[model samples]
Target: MAEITTEDGVQIDLVSGERMKKLRSMEKIRLILDGVRDGNIVILEEGLSPDEESKLIEVTMTEISPDEFAGIEIESYPQQEPNPGFFSRLFGHNPPNKLTVIGPANRIETLHKDKNLIRALVT
Candidate 1:
């Protein structure tokens, strides 16, 4: 379970497993709608399943919030870098850029190609 605070400062416990299941069930569409209406951003500790994550993207694309509930902003923060050795570079890759999605959770980092994708994701 993950603890998520709403914009109103109320904390809600979100069981990732349960929420995923709910999102897969008949409640999915409605739940997505509710999430948008409340101006809440969803965060998963380890991330979400592909299907569930896709649903979130779809829902976010459609829901239009009121001025008071405008969606949050997401920004990418690239890590300072010193290129690693050839072996290290070959064996492992650096982490994707960090993204802080400001809203209920204050910050979240996601690897993305560019700021446009970040903007699309946050909206």
Candidate 2:
């Protein structure tokens, strides 16, 4: 679970993987972009794929407005699998979902990011 607002009243939207799975790639991108435009930080329980992330950047480039909408800042880590069984090693099993954070470029700053942590500054 995630808090809707911080002490300074910054809005945050924590989206679950279940909800994300229900939306198409474009729909998911739109949702993140819209929230960023509204000055809200959006955290995805399951991060987007490489293709989807590229698409999001492409769409954001087209929608950037100098006075109104700044673009977005995004951070994510690759899925980690500590161990792989025989089947996973042979067949290549899917790894667990990763986390992602998206927000207005001007408002959010990624202080640090590693495989297991993402530290962000939101103003």
Candidate 3:
């Protein structure tokens, strides 16, 4: 991985969609976790699937410690489909989420999230 420098003590890694598409599920989780552990915010261009998000939380629980590591904060909104086709409705296939933000819980606070915006405070 290339080095990403922080400005004003904040580092934001914006992972692009093409880069994300090439990684496997576990790889994606590791990438996100590593950034959070290093006190950097990670933004995924194409958000993870529901299963992936759940697995991430599960992994994070195992890694949390009192002094060394804090848990992470994750936020995302599912992409809205203006109209669902009959098959989509019957199959329960929802569109993928638009983006994901992951960071250390103690450092990043999510103030608000709606369909179009996410307001976060980073320390």
Candidate 4:
């Protein structure tokens, strides 16, 4: 087994799409916060909840510093993306949010060089 952490590389989590949506909004937010603090760039295989998205934006703004922000690039796809299509709207079916990369700017930058992290983040 290998250790997993932001320092090690881009940490990822595969959140259950159906289960997450069924959770309370606050629970979703808390779950996101925990992953953020843990230094794992949460890869929501499922889209994020509206409340979860709002809270993520708020926390990112507060938690990261200007200098750190410069070195750490954050990318996130809200569980709820922009205007979905008619079927997605009607069926409430949206693609899994997928990889939300977050970490030290330089570290994230080196992702291209790390095939392992790329594999983990992607697969």
**Candidate 4 on 1-123: residue-level lDDT in tens?**
123546545575556666676778767666765665655555455555444565666766676666544323445444445778888889866554444554443344423423233432321
Kindly list the per-residue Cα lDDT of model 1 for residues 39-82, writing each as its tens digit: 55543322343344456456555554454444333333454357
RMSD of each: 9.2, 3.3, 2.0, 7.1
Better of 3 and 4 by TM-score: 3
| Whole-model lDDT values for every prediction | 0.43, 0.87, 0.88, 0.53
Off-target runs (Cα >4 Å) in candidate 3 are 1-4
Query: What are the clashing pairs of model 2?
Result: none
- The predicted structure with the larger lDDT, 1 or 3, is 3
Q: Model 4: runs farther than 4 Å from truth?
A: 1-7, 65-123
Can you write out model 3's per-residue Cα lDDT over 45-65, one digit (the tens) per residue?
888887788899999999999
- Cα lDDT, model 2, residue 107: 95
When summed lDDT is taken over every stretch of 10 residues in candidate 3, the lowest stretch is 1-10
Clashing pairs in 4: 47-79, 48-79, 71-105, 72-105
Residues 2-119 of candidate 2 have per-residue lDDT tens digits of 6497676889999999898999999999889988899999999988877788899999999998999889999987787787789987986666448999999999999998777899
TM-score of each: 0.37, 0.83, 0.88, 0.47
Please estimate how well model 1 matches the true structure, expressed as its whole-model Cα lDDT. Answer: 0.43
lDDT of 4 at 48: 59
Of the two candidates 2 and 4, the one with more favorable TM-score, higher being better, is 2
Which rank order by TM-score, best down to worst? 3, 2, 4, 1
Model 1: per-residue Cα lDDT at residue 74: 33
